[model samples]
Target: MRTEWSEFRESLRRWIYFRKVRFKRFLKARRAKQEDRLAKRNAPTLIPEGANIRQRADPRQSKIKRLRADFSNDLEETRFRFKQWKHFRWMRVRHFFQAVRTRLADMPSIIGFFKYLLHKRQRSIREQESLSTRKMEAKASSWSKFRSIYLPEWLRRWTIGGKPKSVLLAFLLLTSLVFVLAAYPAYGLLKALRAEQLLENSRELHQKGDLQGAFRKAHASYMLNSETLETFRWLCETAESINYHELLSWRQRLADHPDSGPQDRIKLVRTALDFHQPQVAEEAIRNLREQEVEPSEYLYLRLLTTLAHGRPAKNAAIRQCREILSLPAPPLEAYRIYWSLCLDSMDPRFGREAVNHMKQTAAASGAVGLAALRTLLQLPFEDEKKQRLYSKMLWEHPLAQRHDLLLSLRAVFFGHSLPETALRAALGKQYDRLDNTELQEVTSILNNLGFHENATDLLPTRTMASNKELWVEGLRARIGSDETKETEKVLMEQTPFTESERRFLHSLLLRKNKEFKKADEELVEALRMATASDLPILRKFVLLHEDKATLVALLHRLAKEPAMQRWAQALLILTLQRGAEDEPLEELLGAIQANDYRNNPETANRITRLKVLHGQDLVACRKIAEGLVARYPDVREYRFTLALCYQESDRPVESLRLLEGMLSANPSECPTQRLIGARALLRNGFSSEARELVVGFEKINLLAAERRILDYVLTQTKAKQKGPVLP
Candidate 1:
């Protein structure tokens, strides 16, 4: 059916071409007949005698008239043919058929092109085979010549027959087969070569600090030939190229190679970790364990990798390292690994468990294990239960001969009730057994816990030499309730109080039954000593006082005291208005102006009422505020204060402009700023924008007092709407 349709299309196309030619001939014949008819109609009678000419005409005149008549006939015929050709209805129909025929004729090429393509393919295969044979023959000849000349004596005995070229061809064919067999090997070598070249180049670039480019080249070599162990080795070496997936694949590949040495596998595992592929490193280490490699070394590498990946894997790493440490014939290195994992765990219970394990290990292993147990106990175990376990274990163990451990446990349970008796009980049995150092530790712990005389039982000679103030302070902590001490006095007569010493003394003084006068004297003495050392003791001094006079006097002294002067000056400005008697506001303001701390000058001015007061001196205060505002212009407080000062001194317009800038720059102006701004706007006769600003503030329902501002703005808005209430 397809073939018949195609033949019909070709025949239709030929018919269309034939009809087009026939139609052109018919049009030519029709136009010629029309021209003759027109010539007959337009011709003068006896035009054939026109060459004789008229009596008044010369010879050229007759020819001219004849030419004119002929030209008239030609023009008429041309017009008639042009009019007939305008529509050309038949040509349009023929063109449609021609397009159809042309489309149909092209269809065969489109439909059967695949079938015809087979013939071209056959020719290509034959051509290629012919070329391949010639190539094979040439290769054979070259190989034969190379083999004869270059092959060793034993290789020469392998007979190859026929003419040299035929023998050469056969020899070459065998040689080509050998090469084909060796293609993968050659590919492997080339890949290694490329990798080595890349590694060298990358090393140079890495030395030159082009890490990213070096990573790219090394990555390309790894991708191209990654089947062999060397490729894996290079991939491992170029750690930055080992992305998460490739690292996993290399780990799998390395695991497949059982012959891989422990050191090499370890190197690869480290490489995985360097690439941030902790999971792969973990898997490799596990594989090493399964292969009966040294568990201690690999487990440590895994533990370090897990930690480097962060705390999520810490528990698993701890478990694995513990397994290694638990081995009967464990590597000596496992002890350190176990110790490290314990340090990183941060769980108090784990520390206790570790100490418990150490206890057992020490009984079997001696002082080395006991020393490990002691180190474990030193980790910060804040929980009482954990400390109790540590103390109980130490008391039970024969190797735990150190009374210092029990005393350290007592220190851990100082104030809160954690069976200090139990620690004492344990130590009492071992009291005679302890060395002098252990006895001192026990004495100090007991003394600090306010069992001082009992501590004296442990070390009677040590009691007489202790610091009196420390002894007294410990007594206060152990005996006093806070209320009785609040009325008591504290003194620093014997030794100057450190900050912590002062805190303890302050708390001691605030306790019930403490002498108030003595405590007061102590606080003052402490502050004096603290000031000499440049302590910021004023804040503490203020916390202790209620009467404003004492605070003011202390602040005045502190402000000029040099050691605590700046902090004293700044705090005096902030807190003075709240407590201090009305000094000349100028004194406070003058101290602020002379102050060196620019970082918090705004804080100083805020407390001084600098922006609220109006005077010639207020200009200086405003200048400082403006300088601060200019520095941190985004700060609305500084800007708002400066703007308000401008308005208060009768520069209302400048104030309004400044307020507008502040509002535009920071639309979320606080309620205080909004209130100041609206007032400034009203005073500047910008009653409309002021009403808008006020209405905006009202919408937010900032404060109950803002209703008054809203009322005033509304009154002005209504008045303006009704017509201006002119002055």
Candidate 2:
């Protein structure tokens, strides 16, 4: 009964579904006909009406009439078309029932038909399932392939090698075979790379001018591979040369010296002096003296004299020399003492004395050297007649015959004609005829005496000559005085000196022709070049010669360079020094007083100096002093300078207060501080404080003047019973 109910429900659902589909088709057919007939009926006509203004109909009425006509035609067409479709649908329903009745009578055919339908449905389902399964299987196969391609070795081995022992062994054997096949090529490539590296090293050595090293390296590379010689060239040069390593070993042995003995130190010192390391030579002599061993007499004396003049020790060099000379030894070291006196003494008398002593020594030994005596005679004397005579003798001496003496004679006796032949004979007297410094002096003298043409002819053009300023001045004179334009032609043709020297040249040119603006610009440009080198001191010098407004702008520019900050500091100090008595300096002092960055002790001191010069009132001065002392406790001068400021302001009481504090803490520091303190206290009528400060000075040794001042202050204070004369 339940199966029969399900079958009847199925039949009812199909019947209702088919009938609803047929009804919808019928309604659509009727609506399409109505629309077509309405379109035909509303078609426009070709007939025309008479053009009478009175015959026009109302627009609303005409529209209503046309819509009614269209509605009537639609009604008629829809009714006729609906009847025709109704007849056709009735016949279709009649044929459908007749077919159903025939199917129901043949029960076996119906069952077989249903079975065939079921089989077709089952076959379709199976085909669809098979398609989906194949798609899923393909996706799984693709995933397995991707996992093998990108996964790590451990995972791949775990996944694939789990299959069988024989397969795993085969995989390992194949991997080993591949690695073995690649190893020989890798090893050969590494060997080739090493050989190329060695060849590169050899080439680098050759480029560095180490030709022998390059050759040895090349040969070593060739030993690795004979074919390397075809590419390398260093091997040829290294064939018969000594190896660098052997030479290096020999050098090392020469350098492996123990501490030098006294004689060795003396030799080293003399050698260092010859090499122009006077400071090092002096150090070496000191070391020799420390060893307490005697050097050769000549060498010892020479070291002592060079040390005295060139590189004096912390103590007085002359005193040290005199001590060395006083030693009781052979020849008595008097020759060294005499020569030192000649070099450093302000008189030629010592030079004469040196000559006398050397003569005595040489006479005692009968081998008195003309070199030492001639050196003494050549020394310039303060007395002109004596200098001329000595110069003449030096020029005439056989061994001491020097062009320097002839030039010196001419310079000393300017405007006095030397024999023209003698001057012509000394024509080629370049500076090499004299020592370095003497050459500089001669060039300067010659250029100063309007003898530049002669000086230029005498001086070398190849080497760095002395007296650059003189040369520049000579050029300017020629440009100013000479009419041939020779100097101007030379200037245009010649290369100019560096910025500083060129600046000097331009200054001379400007001074000669009175071209101030052009000269200033040239100097400014030189200054700019020097400033670019970050030399602040040079910038300051340039600013000093410039206008104040220009100087301010230059200082602003210089402030950008870190090196010029020191220059700015120095300029500030100098400006303060020059303008300390001015109102503007007081304003600057005020600004300094208000400054928070008092960490610069020099700026602080400069402020104090300006304050003292400005003569600030006692109150203003004390505040600044207290602030500075609080900020910079170690600045003892601030306190002392502050005391002077107070004393200058007629406030002896405040001055005494400042100085008393300084004297209490630093009694032994500045003797002047104590003296100022005693004087200030006694003047302010604080006799007790003055006496106390005076007693403290007795503990430390004071100069006679300081003691006298203190004594006068004490005597005056006692005599005045009430107070020192206060303002």
Candidate 3:
């Protein structure tokens, strides 16, 4: 068994040795292939030594030699060109330097000039060094003096003694003293600066119309420096200007201050007089008079005191006013007081003279002149010529030429008999300068004056679509005119109105043309997209509905809305009354009365008419109608109601008289008034007069009920056979 095992082992060893030698030979052959590939990749091209000579023996060799010769010649030419280029560059540089040298040679030696500059630089450096040394010496001397004065030898010894606790305490105490001394002045300076900054901010805030913020800032400034008279003066002036409640307190402060100057006292007195505290103004004036006040100032205060206190010394006050005006450049306050006294005395000549003088002085008197001019414009002169003259003078004044002044003029004289061209010129010239409020006022004035086209033209280019209703009113005014069709054409072409406004305006135009159904449909669509402000237009459109039930239903829906409640309720009541729904009419009237409809004249009139229609309380109806007539006499509807009340109360003569006056004033304007007048005439046995009135109605567009009444009146007149009776 041992021998067999030995043989197997020997076989295994031989197999292992054979495998190892085969693997070794494989690796060596692989390495040799890789080396060969590397050698081939890196090797240079090789040629036989006689290959060139063989090529040279051929004709192609001569071509090769010629090519070589050409290449050599080109290289030589390139080198020669490069050398010439370098020579040319060097010569140009040399010529430039030679020109500079020639230019310098005509002036001064370059080296000597440089030497002089160097000398100047050295001298500057030396001077700077000397200055620095002198500064250092001065600092040293100052330090020495400080040490000699403040730091005694004993104190220096104590500092150097190295008693650690004592040294730290002394250092701390001295540092605290130094900090306290430095910080006290710095704190005062910072407070003063802060107060000054606040004052500046207050002025800016006041200019921006932030009166509350300005008051706070001004108050803080005064609190920080109560001794500053200017700060106190500003606080007082601002308080008075903004009508702040603290005005009295600030004025008292200024008056009480010992350092208050004559100007401060004068201001305090003027503010007192303006606030209607004559006693306070008198005392202030007395104090000022004691302090050597100006003659004009004293006399002005005296005149003001006299005027404010009911003119106790009227003649003396007038003489004082005259004295004040006699001064060169008399105070504006004097002129203002004199004008008031003249007005109170009913002296038109003197008042006119004062106004003329005020106008002449307004050019140079700043705010005072503007105030005087405003007062003059507000005067109630009966003569139109005088009014026009005053207005013209005001318009010509430089102070009155401001945009704000123009707005003030419009406010004061919008409804008065001012020249339209002059007013229009003034407004148009400064239209671009108006702010939003002023612009809105101008547009409203233009609209009220029947200048709708001008108002439309003056609308801002960038107005919001939400304000299209205002522009629509202008367009509504153009309806039925020659421009109406052209306006509609232009509106169709342009999109100035929003989709809703355009629809609403189209509905309005359609309604004017009597296309009710289409207009109603368009209006419904518009109302769906309409804002609250658009409800009035919608209400007017809804009122034009021929279908009473539909109108009532629509009005009922609108009445449910809080914003449209009042108008819709009134409209609904009228619709119900017109439909002869008396049962619901009483409940609606009670609801309206319960809801405080008396505050509105239309609703109250409706209530009165309902009462009259019911005949429940004719006396109460008459009283209410009379009250309405008295309250709004200019309102034709109220007067018509009163006429109806008079007719219903069996006073036919009174009713006829009222109706006749109405007819005379507004001939055929009010159909209801004409109808009532015919009824009154028929009842009063003036059938011929009734026939004459009813005949006028045939030429007008009358309602069915009105035409029936007219026909009945004409038949009754014919039956009576009354001929041409003048009642």
Candidate 4:
């Protein structure tokens, strides 16, 4: 044990010695580096041989020396001026004291002369006072004699000679004038009071959901006091609650009123813009410009006017918008205008910068920020960074509503690589706040996007669970699920299903289960309980069934519904063409033409297809196809249809020409168009070109029908390749 301990201690000592030596080496190296740095920093400055050292000194140092010398000279001059000013001040003080001494020397004589003159003036004043008293007594006596001789008794008794009755009559006349002057204000006060009362009643009615009563009261209040902006706002709000037409009328009324203030007119213009009534907005803005308005308000109206003019005045609008936004603290409307102009430009960079500016500015906490966020969602952002930044801003915005967040999430979902889990969570939170109708819409959108589980999880846990309409939608979603059989069974066993709705649900489930006869029976029962509005539901059932009799019966049944008559007739035409029932289809077309419904593009297109399919009136079908091609030159389907029409009309040259144009325009029509084009080429007696066109089409995964068509074309080309057969 002692030997082991000795060995361990020796090893420890060796390790300690090695560490010390390494530490010493490191310290020596650090010291050497410091010394080398100091030596390099203090290296001698290079100088030309025989050069003047003073002249070659640093320019900065020389400038500093010159500044110091100039400052010293300025200090000396300042001190010298101070001394000269003090001497001048002392001399002025001496002169002031000398003048005072001279005045003191002349004071006694001046006082004695003044005393002698004062005694003489007092004696003269005494003599004049006695004469003035005697003159006054003589004048008074003469006036008394004159009054006694000229005055009459009737003049002494007149109202001007102190009669209280005339005084009272004059006072009453002045009082009457005052009352007349105040009467207008008194009437205005009474009307204003009435308007206030009416507005209060309107509020009460609005709260009670009596929108019509609220509208009447609010309109009455506005008529009573048209000058009050609040009354006008209440009127517009009430009208909007009642109906769109009413709101429009109120907006026009307020805009046309001569007495409306700037606020009223501005609100009118804003509401018109919001409702996309640009004409009304323009008229309101024109009237506002004609009236007196503040500078900011005038600028705001100008921005609105420029925006209403659209792209024609975009440059001017952008300049004015930038100027307004450059103000120290511009109004929220200025930010709104900036964003509007940005959106109009459709420049994603401008949108991104404007959104960033809005986020940093005080406008981000208010309606301006909300508008910016909404606009940001509409902008086509190309960068994922900007999209994520905008998403973060929207998520953290204090004023963002559930709808706003959901829209932001949707924007991010489409524009960025945000996690689906995060999007689902945000949508789920908003789902809880949405009303029944909004929930239904959001759920449908989710289902359509294939987020079935997320949509099912987002269902409302409260009143919506008991909502019959929502329950039906949920069942439909389940029926569309992968586990349709199980979901259908669950739906069948559920309680609270209406008889008509149960029949409808059962029909859908039966159809999914391939029990068509039972499904048709259920559908008929459901149709019996259905209303005119249920035509869409019945149409879905018709589309599911392949039986010509079932489709015709459904169409005939739907024809009785006035709202569904036209739709039913269109569907009947499609059904007849599908079944190749030429006579019935022609008769239906004649009836439709008699009704002038065939003039519609949809009906005309359908009729053209029917003629093409039935091989009847190929010339007329070609004419219709030509018109379709002319009307929709860019639509490939129209062009293809025209090609088909040409092919069937025995105009294979024209058909091949159209097909060649289609292929040249887009060669990616690898299988379908090439097959058709090859057939057209073969029909046009170009067997070699046709063989080359479809040489490799079989390598593609062609459908059985496509393969058969290709095989027939190839067989014809091969048969023609051999020499003519001997008879």
For each predicted model, how many residue pairs clash, with residues at least 3 apart or on different chains? Answer: 19, 0, 0, 0
Q: How close is candidate 3 to the true structure, as a TM-score?
A: 0.34
lDDT (tens digit, per residue) of candidate 4 on 669-725: 335456667677677676766676687776666544456658978898885553221
| Tens-digit lDDT string for candidate 3 (512-560) | 6778899779767876677665556655445333456546656766787
- What lDDT is obtained when candidate 2 is compared to the true structure? 0.54
Worst 10 residues of 2 by lDDT: 308-317
Ranking by TM-score: 4, 3, 2, 1
Displacement of the residue 593 alpha carbon in candidate 3, Å: 36
Evaluation by TM-score, superior candidate among 1 and 2: 2
Indicate the residue-level lDDT of 166 in model 4: 71
The whole-model lDDT of each prediction reads: 0.57, 0.54, 0.67, 0.67
Best-to-worst ranking by lDDT: 4, 3, 1, 2
632-654: candidate 1 lDDT, tens digit per residue: 45445666777756765688777
TM-score to true structure, per model:
0.29, 0.33, 0.34, 0.37
Poorest stretch of ten by lDDT in candidate 1: 479-488
Error of 2 at 363 (Å): 12
Candidate 2's error at 654, in angstroms?
A: 24
Q: How many backbone overlaps does candidate 3 show? A: 0
Model 3 lDDT, full chain set = 0.67
